[model samples]
Target: MSDTLGAAVIGLGMMGERHAQLWAELPRTRLVAVYDIVPERAQAVADAHGCLAASSLDEALAADGVDIVSVCTDDQSHLQPCLAAADAGKHVLVEKPLAITTADCDAIIAACERADVKLMTGHVCRFDPRYVACHDAVAAGEVGDVVQVFARRNNILASGLRIGPRTSVAYFLGVHEIDLICWITGARVTRVHAEGTSKALASIGADDSILSLIRLEGDAVGCIETCWIIPEGSANSLDARLEVVGTEGRVAARVGGEPFEAASASRSSRPDIVYWTEVHGRVAGALRDQLEHFADCVLDDTEPIVTPAQARHAVQVAEAIHHSLDTGAPVDL
Candidate 1:
């Protein structure tokens, strides 16, 4: 067995809690400390995982045993914690849209490189079974000369109310599909034209939704649509799907379905059929797989499957989309 790496979680939001849980659960990992701006949240997470609640980011990075840090902070708050961890010589697994801007992404990359530590962005959709299969099929040329791609990720207002204040729908929901389209097609986005509407979320300082028309350096064209204004009556939190078309064939998948469903007078919902689920009474799925990949890369000294450069490019594309939204013109990338 590989030596277990000690881990620290730097945030205690919903996603941060998941990271702490998995860090403790992984066979070659140990949760050593937790940190959050809110001490109570940090303490609660630390208590749940039997680890220390660090008083600050520095304390967490300097913890006696932590060799890995998971930066699960808000979209705009990822860079500082990442830089601290890298400077402290800890491998980092930062949640996606690594930063709100391209310059910040570049800075994190350079800092980690200088410190000689592995830096990973949490674009976990690439690790999802459905997306993984799509990538494999494309690699095998099953799709044969990719021609077009259509992807959609929409969600109910409940999630938007929480997330939209921190980042736009494009970065919050569109970044995953943006990364996936580029990952599978093996093409960089050369130009982008995007339009966003602010019907429901305008008052919150972000668009309710966005649609981007993307031009790849290669021949394939893409349209990625993301909206978070779905009604409360919706059956699921997300209405997500991905479809890729080519000369010889096409592949498509609906992102969320239910292995179980339930209803009450208040509302109805469908639990995830895949991604993250309790398998035999424990957390397991692509989220775990993504973390495992990061752990393995750190333990074995393998290159990350998702490079920092690619993660930076996704941020660039997201920025370009927002620029387009502002100017009503497509920005060449």
Candidate 2:
């Protein structure tokens, strides 16, 4: 076998393009194939990465030498291709929420386990330095027995217009915090209470914001607040914050700071200072780091930092939260 791993990307949207570029650039990974429901999009990515534009997902999965598949499809459409990849004996790196339903997530997990293939969810927040460092602090006992947490991911209204129609705020925006809070505290969410409203995005029939009160094992309670109704003219694309209060101390983090700010006649805004930033003409920061880690783990035959089971649990929690939103009551997990 070659030292480099052969990879295929399914889905040619923004994230598919990113994954294609990362596969081509990673030290020991080769971008070998690309696929999408749209032929032109697949061909565009294939041409850019110097790979084949597979006629179908099966062709991509069965491409000679391809050992890894990156599933970048929409949140609700992740299960089928994942199962196909597992059947092809290919390792999978699926973009989060994993799936819209816990049963689908469970099927993906079980298929991968039976196929003896590794599966990792793309919960990029867990890989970000801001959140990763905080998680480490909590795990290191610096925060000493986390008792409470609060996390928020408020995006500009543009996101509400673009994404809210396809997925809920709970799965699309709240999943990050759901996964991160659990990862940091190493606890299972045992119950959830949530409320939501859709007036701001009524035209699209989508929820504008949601708040979830999640209770975890060991009695550690957390809040997940997600809103996609930030005005288009807001200073930043996102308003995100995470805080964990422990018995002995607390850790807080926010993605902010950059020397760049634009104050125009009509509006004002600030450039993002972290996560994925273009530097010296290429993508860098936590996005690249996470892809690097994925490729490295594949090459070294090691377990991923984010496992299928853990990702499944995150989906379970997100589903419960959605149920709570619907029933206007608490859900016990």
Candidate 3:
């Protein structure tokens, strides 16, 4: 095998395109093939990147030089591509919220395990410097005995309008915090009491906002706020914050309020510079770091930082949150 791995992206949406671009740009990986439900979309991406525009999932997996598959399908459509990738003997790097349900998550995990291939979910928050620093501080005892955690991730109305019709806000946004808080505190969420409102996305059968009160394994508690109904005039497309309060001290990270702001006649904006951004004519940031990490792990034959079980834990917690919302009562895991 060559030192550089070849990658295939299975979805051509925003995230999938980013993955394809990064694989082409990254040092240890090369974009070899791409596939989307729309052949024209796949062709456009392939033409831009000089890769094959596969007509089907099997063709994409079988494309010459392909070693890894990046699954960036919709929130509810991750299982089939993941299973197919494993069957083709390729490593997988899937986007977060591994699946909408725990059973689907298990099936994907089992398939990869059976094929003896690497599997890593794309929990990009884990790769964010802000969250990484906070996790490190808590792990270093700077925050001593965590008592509680609070996380908020809100996006502009455009996001709600674009994604609400397809997926719930909890799975789309809250799952990031669900996985992040558990990772930072090193505890499992034991129970959850969740409530949701549906003013903005009610017509689409999606919630505008979801708030979850979570109890962890060690009795530490957390509050998670996820909404995508912020007005477009807001300074940033994303508004997120995470704070961990401990017996001795506290640590927190804030987004949407970056100092780098650009103002225009109509509105002032703070464009995203952390997740994925064009820098020096190429995509760079946490998302790039994440893809690089997955490629490196596959090349070195090592386990990924974001393990399948850890990803499944997030789904389990999400399921509990939905259950709580349905029952209008606290649910125990």
Per residue, candidate 1 scores C-alpha lDDT tens digits across 1-333 of 249899999989988999999999999899999999999999999989899999989988888889999999999999899999999999989999889899999899999999999999999898888888888998899999999999999998998899988888888888998999999888999999998888788788889889999998776899999999898788888888999899988888777656578889987789775767888866898889999999999999999899999999999999999999889998998
Off by over 4 Å in 1: none
Extract clashing residue pairs from model 1: none
Clashing pairs for model 2 are none
Ranking by TM-score: 3, 1, 2
Candidate number of the best lDDT: 3
Residue-pair clashes per prediction, in order, are: 0, 0, 0
Worst 10 residues of 3 by lDDT: 255-264
Work out candidate 1's RMSD over C-alphas: 1.3
- Work out candidate 3's RMSD over C-alphas: 0.7
185-213: candidate 3 lDDT, tens digit per residue: 99989999999999988788889999999
Error of 3 at 138 (Å): 0.5
lDDT of 1 at 99: 93
Query: Can you write out model 2's per-residue Cα lDDT over 41-144, one digit (the tens) per residue?
Result: 99999888789999999999988999999999989889999999999999899988888888998899999999998889999887788888998898899988
Candidate 2 wrongly placed segments (more than 4 Å): 256-259, 262-265
